[model samples]
Structure formats: C-alpha cells, structure tokens
Target: MTAATDGTRVTIIGVGPGDNGFLTLKGKQAIEEADLVAGFQTVLNVVIPFAKNAELCPMAYRDQEEVLDYAVGQVKEGKSLVVCAWGDLNVSAKELLDRVRRRVDHVDLVPGISSVQIAMSRSGISLEDVVFITLHRRDGKESALEELVYYLKDGRRNIILLPSPYDLMPAGIAAGVIEDGVPGDHRMTVYQRLTHDDEQSWSGSVSECAAITTDFSDLSIMI
Candidate 1:
C-alpha cells in the first residue's frame, strides 16, 4: 500500500546502536511526533521513552510484515508512523529500509550513529581506510562472506564487519577468511555491545579468533 496523499508520512528512524544516548536529535523528534511506532522489540525498547505519545507496535521476524502493514494502514487513516531500526540506516539496515519502502511510497529516513562508528573509534581506524560488510541480512550471506574474503585478500583497507548472529559470526568469519587464503596471523578485533556499559572487545590473530569458543553477544562487530 502507498502512503496517503494528504501529506501523512511514514518515517524510518535509526535509533542508534544499542544506546539511546547516541540517538540523533532529528531521530528523537521523529519518534516523539509519531502517532504509531513499530520496530523489533529490542529496537522499540531503546526508543520507548521518546515515543511516549505513539502506540507501540513490537514485531519479530515472523510477523514484521503484518506489523508494517498495520503501520501503513494507520498512516492511511492520516496518522504519522515511525519504524525504528538499530544503528545507522546507511549501514546494516538496508533490508529493513527496503521492506519499509515496499509498503509505503513516501518514507523519510533519519540516520543515527552506527556501532561500526563506535568500532572505528575504539579501534582507531579511519573511515576512508575501512571497508564495511554486514552479514546481518536475512539472506544472501554466502556472497557477503565471499565479499569479505575478497576485501581481506586485497589487504589495503581495514574491514568493519557485522556478522550474522545465527551463523558467520566472528569466529566463523575469521575461519572463512583464513580458509580463503587470508593469513591466519592477520590481526582481528571483535567488539561486543559497543556503546553499552558492559561493552567488551577482544583483539588477536585471525587464527586465535577462529579458535575462540567463548560466546559473544549478538550485538558484535569485527575489525
């Protein structure tokens, strides 16, 4: 369904990594003004305080379509809707943005800070010297893994990667890169729960990371 022609708009706002403090001013204003807000429960929780005036619509992967459709219907009724996403929309949230765009004709995006930026600051890497790849999407991970390997082999730029939580996590990604001819001794750092109080980071050779058995948080990035 398309957005209502009476100027009602659906906005997709990035809530910024896991920390609400990182939320941008524009993003905060959008959420605060929304009539209906929808997002994964975790993301919604981060923006709950700012979305005080809106009806909360928490959704999971299995029911995201239904929830988004409901938000669109609300927009049709002349109410403003905001769909929250974790991190910056330009980074790992393209899939979510694509889904939102498919259901609404006029969707405004408000970008927020991404964990990748946090990782960069923590690792002292410049954005121009880094290539980012996220395996966080629902599908097409094999090619993403290949792209990671390809970049790793290039050896000119550092990589900031968001691995798939289900598989291809830090260890799996390290192993895959090593198997694909990137040196096992290449330095790698894994940052977990960035921008949060319990944030943790581990830095070691690719082989060491591949051998790691310790469970890492789902909110993790590798550099």
Candidate 2:
C-alpha cells in the first residue's frame, strides 16, 4: 500500500461496541493488512485475532498521547497500521485522531455500529425522532445537565451518551431531569455493556432510577 510522506499512514477502524461480531468486514480486512494494530486494551483484545501478523500496541484512555507518539514513530518507519476503537472510532477517538492527523497526513476511517445506534435499536426507538447528546468528553458537572434540560423540555425522546462522572450517570441524569421539571414518572432505560453477551439493560421511571446507587460500567449507555 502507498504511504504518506516519510511513509506513515493511519487507518482508523471502528471496532464496534465491545463485540467481535460487530466488527465490519472492511475493518477486519484493514486489521489483516496492517503492520501494526493499536488501541485500548479491550479493543486490542477483541481485534487481536484479525491482527495476528501485526504488532499490537495497547493503551488506555489516558495514554492516548503516548499511543499516538508510538503510532507516528511506526508510520515514519513505513509501517501500515490500523487503530482500533470502541464503538465508532470517530466518537471516542475524535480528540486523539485530531492530534494525530496533524502529523500523519494519510488517514482512513471505517465506520462501525456505535453504542448510540445499538442503544437506540435495542430500545426500539427511531433516531430521527430523538435528541442526541454526548457527555463522554465534556465536563458533565458544567453544562451537561443544562443542555439535557433544554432537550428534555422539548418532550422528544432523548438518547444521551453519559460520561463516567460522579454526577452524570443514569441516576444523576434522572435526578437532573426530574429537577428540571420533568415528572419523576418519565420512563428511560440504562443499557450496560451494550452488545456484549453479558450485556444488561434496566428500564424504570426517573424517580425509580434516581434511587439506584449501583455503579455502572464505563460502557453503560442511557436512553
């Protein structure tokens, strides 16, 4: 395959919501063709089989800069690579890729089923009729609730991407909505570890959910 200047090319592959079955054919092909496969440990594990011949570089969310540096070094060495990501790479890897792109000129991205789509599908809700918001990268304690309230006030169904923050979880989201004038009886669902074999989902009213103190996984989704 052709490469950019200095021979570094990056292919960002969306591995889907923590399930190997969700990986697209194109994504798999990219992995098989790459010389390096890099991403979070969980995603790296899921894609390891396809990257049998490629070097695997595992990194955590906080290690994004380090991972990008390593990837750039490999690309400069003329290695073809595929970077795995949970859900759609564009969703969680936006900030990471944004920085990497400034260094690596040739980049390609393959889309996969995002957790947002899977949550909406499992809930049997039409995305066209819902308001979508993501607190995944934002400081939830800041404007997350305010923006949520604005949409919640519209009365349209909402599909929110919650961050793993103390005050923006399913319970906290419910409490915020209830305090924003929505009735406690409003219905919503919390989908945990979405799309995985052990995935679990809970449905309840806002008030009922507010009483829950059980912590959810980092992959949980609320709708």
Candidate 3:
C-alpha cells in the first residue's frame, strides 16, 4: 500500500470484454495485489478471485464520479487500489476518467479485448469490411443510422454498432433504417455478454430483432 500523493490516486485496470482471461497480465497482477478493488457488479465478480482481501466498491450506472471520489479519497488515505473496467478502461470510462485524470497526478490504465475486436473475431467478419458506430447516446441521433443505411444500400459497406441500452437497440435501429426508407432485410448479429455469463448470439433479419429483449449489460451488434 502506497499513497496517492506519491503520484496517482487510482490504477484503472481493463478486464477485457466481459471475460477475465482476456485481461492483461499486468491488470491481473494489479488486482491481485490491490488493497481495494472498485467496479460494477459484473467486474467485481470476475476480479474477486484475484483481489487480495481488497475492499470492493461497486458503482451503478452513471455513478462514476462517486466511485472516483471514493477512489481518490482512499489513495489519500494510503490504500493501494485498482479500479476495474470493461475492455480498456480508458476507452469505456472516457467521460469520467478524463475529469478524474485532471484531479489526480497518476492513473494506471490496463488494456483488454474490445467488443468490436471480439465481434469481428466471432463473426469472422473481415476487419477491413466494416464501419463501426456507437448509438448509445441519449439523443436519438438517427443521422448516424441513416448514414449507415446509405452505405449498406450502396452495397459497398458493412457496419458494426454498439447499441445504447434500451433506448436505441438493434431493433430500434432497424426501425430507423426503415423509417429512413432503406429496405431489404439486412443480416444482423447480437452478441450478448460478449465474453461471459450466458453469452448468446442471434443471427437474423433486422426486423425480427426489434421485438427481442434489449438488456445489454455487456453486448454488441453487427449489421
């Protein structure tokens, strides 16, 4: 255990796309030796085995500021801690970590397998054959989906989307495509929990998927 004033308050470790094995060796080591491990419930479950009697602090949706505050406080209190995240923490936790980074002098970010990387691997979709988009924003930005449809219809492009929780799901995307007047049933894939815990996949037309469940705790979409 060291103190944050020595440099940084938190060591952010990326557990890799829902699967612990995909986590970096350095990340595993950090968690194993950490005095405190903080993350969401899912990340906590996977890291628990390696945490050396570390206290856990689980953050729920959008509670990142609180988590970071606690982490910085702990570091000030001289506790060695590793903050867990999905796939590269820097990539997924960007919004908040950026703010936290300005407040702290040091943060160790560990990289891991990204969902897009895994989605490509699982679908055997050529890395060179697709465009990736993130539709998880609160604003129902149909512009992105509209543009994707344009490319898909041009028959010259393929897209992989990271859908927003329930507000902007694959089904809803399909609806958007139709609303945008893009016809023809496009093939789609949904990989739920990408790398762990009842991971599932469904390959079908975009229309059929609209009615399916959209509980994307950790998942991806391919179109």
- Least accurate 10 contiguous residues by lDDT in model 2: 1-10
Tens digits of per-residue lDDT for model 3 on 96-190? Answer: 45656776778767776677788889988786998767675545457766767777777666787877776777777777776776663767788
TM-score-best of 1 and 2: 1
Clashes of each: 0, 0, 2
The TM-score, computed over Cα atoms with residue i paired to residue i, of candidate 2 is 0.90
RMSD of each predicted structure: 2.3, 2.7, 3.6
Using lDDT, give the best candidate's number: 1
Give lDDT: candidate 2, residue 45: 82
TM-score of 3: 0.84
Error of 1 at 76 (Å): 0.9
TM-score of each: 0.93, 0.90, 0.84
Score candidate 2 by lDDT.
Answer: 0.79
Residue-wise C-alpha lDDT for candidate 1, range 1-223, written one tens digit per residue: 5435635468888899888999999999998888999999989989999988999999999999999899898998888899999888898788889888888767788989988888999989899999888889888888988888888888999998888886778888888888889999899899999987799999999999999988888999999
Q: Candidate 2 clashing pairs?
A: none
Against the reference, the lDDT scores of all candidates come to 0.88, 0.79, 0.73
Candidate 1 collision pairs: none
